[model samples]
Target: MSKHKKAAPQQRQEMSGVERLGLRVSSMINHPIAQTQRWVVIHRLDTDGEAEWEEVIGLLAETPELDLTFNDDGAVTVRWERSALQERDDFIIDEDNEVETEVAAPF
Candidate 1:
C-alpha cells in the first residue's frame, strides 16, 4: 500500500497586477523588430530567476571556449566557434579492415 494520498485539484488563481505587468513588459523585450530572431528564456516566477541567471553567467565564465561579456547597457554577449561539418575529412575502410582518410581531389 502507498502512504501518499492523491490530493484534489486546486482552484485556478487570477493573475496579480505585478505578474500581468511583468508579462506585458517582458514580452516587449525580445519582440523588438531590430533583430529578426533571438533566443529567450521565460520564467513564470521571478524568485528563481536570479540564481538561474548567475548559473548561466558562471557557466559562460568558466568555459574557455565560450566568449562571455556584459555590456554597460545590460546586454550580454555569448558566442563560440565550431568547425563546419562539411570541413571534416571523410573516412574509408580498406578490405584489410584498416581505416584511412579519403583523399580529396584538387579543384
Candidate 2:
C-alpha cells in the first residue's frame, strides 16, 4: 500500500500596519467629497505622530495618482488631477444617454 501525504494549507499574506494606513488614506482621498473638492487634508492622529504620519504619506505617495504637500502643522494635503480619474471609462458621463432618457411629455 502506498502512503498518502497531506498538503499543508497556504497562508494568505496580510496587510502591514503601513499598508493599512495607506489604504485608509487612499479611501478617504477617493471619497466623493474629497474627489469633488480635488483636495483632502490629513491630520496626524493620536496613534500616529508626525514622523509616523510622514512615513505613511511617503509610502502612499509612491503612486503617481496623488500630489502630496506636507504642512508645518503636521498635516498632509493630497490632491489629484480630475483628468487622472476621468481617464477611467466609468468616470465619464454619457450625455447622449441622458438625452435619450428624456421622453416627451404627454399632452
Candidate 3:
C-alpha cells in the first residue's frame, strides 16, 4: 500500500503595507544570480503613473545595511540580506510619508 500525507492549511499573517513591501523587496534582492547589468524595475500602477525605481535607488543609497551595486551598463543590483530588509523598510516608510504629506497639503 502507498502511503500518503495530507497537506496542511496555509496560515495567513496580517502585515502592514510597509511590511508587505519589505517582503517584496527582500524576495527581489534574493533572486538567483544573474547577469551583472540587467536592471529589474518594480512598477506601481497608482500615483499617476509614477515608477518606484528612483525610490528604490535612494533607499539603497541612504541605508548602510544594504549592499547595492551598479553595473557599468547602469543596472543596479542588491546583493545583501540585511541591506534588502533595510531598503524595503525605507521604501515603505518613504511611501507612507509621501501619502501623509499629500493628504495634509491644501490643493
lDDT of each: 0.41, 0.64, 0.44
The lowest-lDDT stretch of 10 consecutive residues in candidate 3 is: 98-107
Residue-level lDDT of model 3, residues 69-89, one tens digit each, is: 676765555544433443454
In the range 1-107, model 1's lDDT, one tens digit per residue, is 99999999999999754556444433432232201122222332454355555554565467565455576654455443332211323311122432343432111
Candidate scoring better on lDDT of 1 and 3? 3
Leading candidate by lDDT: 2
* Clashes per candidate, residues 3 or more apart or on different chains: 0, 0, 2
How far off is model 3, as Cα RMSD? 16.1
Cα lDDT of candidate 3 equals 0.44
* Segments of candidate 3 deviating more than 4 angstroms: 1-24, 30-51, 81-107
When superposed on Cα atoms, how far off is each prediction in RMSD? 16.4, 10.1, 16.1
Model 2 collision count: 0
* Candidate 1 least-lDDT 10 residues: 32-41
- Please list the residue runs of candidate 1 whose C-alpha ends up more than 4 Å from where it truly belongs after superposition: 1-48, 84-107
Which parts of model 2 are misplaced by more than 4 Å? 1-15, 49-52, 88-107
User: How well does model 1 score by local distance difference test?
Assistant: 0.41
Error of 1 at 101 (Å): 34
**Pairs that collide, model 3:** 65-83, 66-83
